[model samples]
Target: MADFETILERGGALILPTETVYGLFASALNEEAVKGVYQLKRRPLDKALNLNVASLEDILAFSKNQPPYLEKLYQTFLPGPLTLILEANQAVPSWVNSGMASVGFRIPSHPLTLDLIRKCGPLIGPSANLSGQASGLHFDQIQADFKGQVDGFKDDDFLTGQDSTILDLSTSKARILRQGAISKEELVSALPQLIFQD
Candidate 1:
């Protein structure tokens, strides 16, 4: 297993796989690391990155309110390819959330990625690519793009070529921000009570 804790502590960033795509991951607890990710990608500070958490409990910890259908949503789509956006609570650091009231998060299904998150804690994981570029799907493409500048690279098989579906539950009604592995119709079929605006 990679000593991601040390890698993140020293370098502030690493390349790791997610269920959706390889991500330029950094410790959410480390403001400097979070800054590095944005700088590395040339990503605008105004834009927010999604949090990669170990489990459902972590999601609840960072979020403001626990919706009644959260469990059902998790059961149906999580550890799969769903990125959920929720209202952030006090526990979520401003650096991680960029002071946005809403925070996006994922529970990655890829075993190695999941293990790293479980052992090292929450990470802010954006797709491994420069800002405005298409997300890399293969390890070689990412490695070539990053040009050996990062501390570590854990390559793996493509779990899914598509990005995770971005579902916003921050408001009273649910909305689909970005459609990916999961579909809006699927969400409606699974959780019938909630209204959806795609």
Candidate 2:
């Protein structure tokens, strides 16, 4: 395995496997590194990037407000395949959110991903593929798409081949942005008062 902390500290990006699809990762707080991910993926500057955090405290560092029921939601879905959108605090760079007021944060259930985040701080994790392409679900696919584009690759055999379920908790009511591993019914089952956005 590559020294992920060194690679990130040197402003390099990595192709990291998660419980979901492989992701192109760079230190979320490192503006240059984050920009490199955008450049390599040919992703639009306006599109926001999701962050991978090691813990709830990491999420709190970038969150401006603590919404009601957030703890309950986190307790039920965190360290799994759910991504939460929360109001961004000043700690989060504008580049990560594309100047948006809110940002998406996830704590992947994969141990390797969690370890890397713990070592290098939160990471900007976008699907490891060129813009508009399918997400890379395995190392071979990632290598074919980004072998030369990233600093290093972390190999893992486990992958769910699906992105996290995204929930928008930045507002008073919860809204499902993207359904993946976690279903709307599952979320509603946990929090019946939650509202779904059309």
Candidate 3:
């Protein structure tokens, strides 16, 4: 394993692989690192970003509440291509929350990312491409875009070419906010009885 601490300690953003797509990574709790990601992507503050954890324990740490439906979703969809939108706890920064008081979290299903995150702890991540650009499908595609902005880059041998399915689990009822790599059919099948509000 690479020295994840070196990456974190240096405060450089990293290009990490995720089940959805390659992500530009930074310490979720580091304001400078988080700001660097926003600068690199040219993303707006209101967009915030998603936090990717390496384990279920890490996920629980950032959430305000772990409702029954959320637990069920974790049991079924985690360590895969799913992002759970939930109420943020105090550990998360306002920059990450976009001042919304809630955040999206996931345990990505890419091996290199899981390994690195296990070492570096939870990460704030966004697609590894410049804001408004197409999602990168290969390492070479990401190289020019990321270049010196991030500390390290992992190729597509680890990253999937599409984004994950984002589900808002913050409310009492579940809802699908974005449909991407994970199909609606698969999600509906996973929880057949539940209604997909919005």
Candidate 4:
């Protein structure tokens, strides 16, 4: 419904499709724009947000404590449906982490999301639906929550209904926050050596 670059350039959040579902995106480094995402989602300030980066190299800049397990996880699941919560580097905003020291980051498998991130650089893409609601995949499903808040809306067939697997790699332990598209069994099999937390 709107231009991707324009929204990011104007410091506005965008509602776009991901491999999982629709997400509201803003520049990861733009504090004001990131705040706008919270307002649009009606999400609380303390919940924190998720970031979509252009490439693996982009992550190195914001990942302070990249343990060997995380590196293995990156190699195994990145450029796919997974979010890695890690301790943020200096470049990440405190607000992005809800004043916490860590941030959740993802490299989505969706072509459009990747393309947009490549264009605008890194961005924060909170869920497109309202807080504590069903995440939408189509614009019609999302219109109620974000009709007025988002600068643009894009609905592709790929993101009809799915969600990313969440992995917390901030500490020495790899915690499975939520199991979505990526199976817990597969993760364990890939990183058999890494410890899994309850």
Give the candidate number with the greatest TM-score: 2
Model 3 C-alpha RMSD vs. true structure (Å) is 2.1
| Per-residue C-alpha lDDT of model 3 across residues 17-101, encoded as one tens digit per residue | 7877788888887888889889998888788788888777777888887665566667787888888888888888788878786
**Model 1, 62-99: lDDT tens per residue?**
99776789989898777878999999999888877779
Point to the candidate with the largest lDDT: 2
Name the weakest run of 10 consecutive residues (lDDT summed) in model 1: 1-10
Write out the backbone clash pairs for model 1.
none
At residue 92, what lDDT does model 2 achieve?
Answer: 82
**What C-alpha lDDT does candidate 2 achieve relative to the native structure?**
0.86
* lDDT scores of the candidates, listed in order: 0.85, 0.86, 0.78, 0.80
Q: State how far residue 8 of model 3 sits from its true place (Å).
A: 1.5
| Clash pairs detected, candidate 2 | none
Alpha-carbon TM-score of each model against the true structure: 0.94, 0.94, 0.90, 0.92
Off by over 4 Å in 4: none
Write down the RMSD of candidate 2 (Cα, Å).
1.5
Instruction: Name model 3 segments beyond 4 Å from true.
Output: none
Ordered from best to worst TM-score, the candidate numbers read 2, 1, 4, 3
Global local distance difference test of model 4: 0.80
Model 2: how far residue 109 lies from native, Å: 1.2
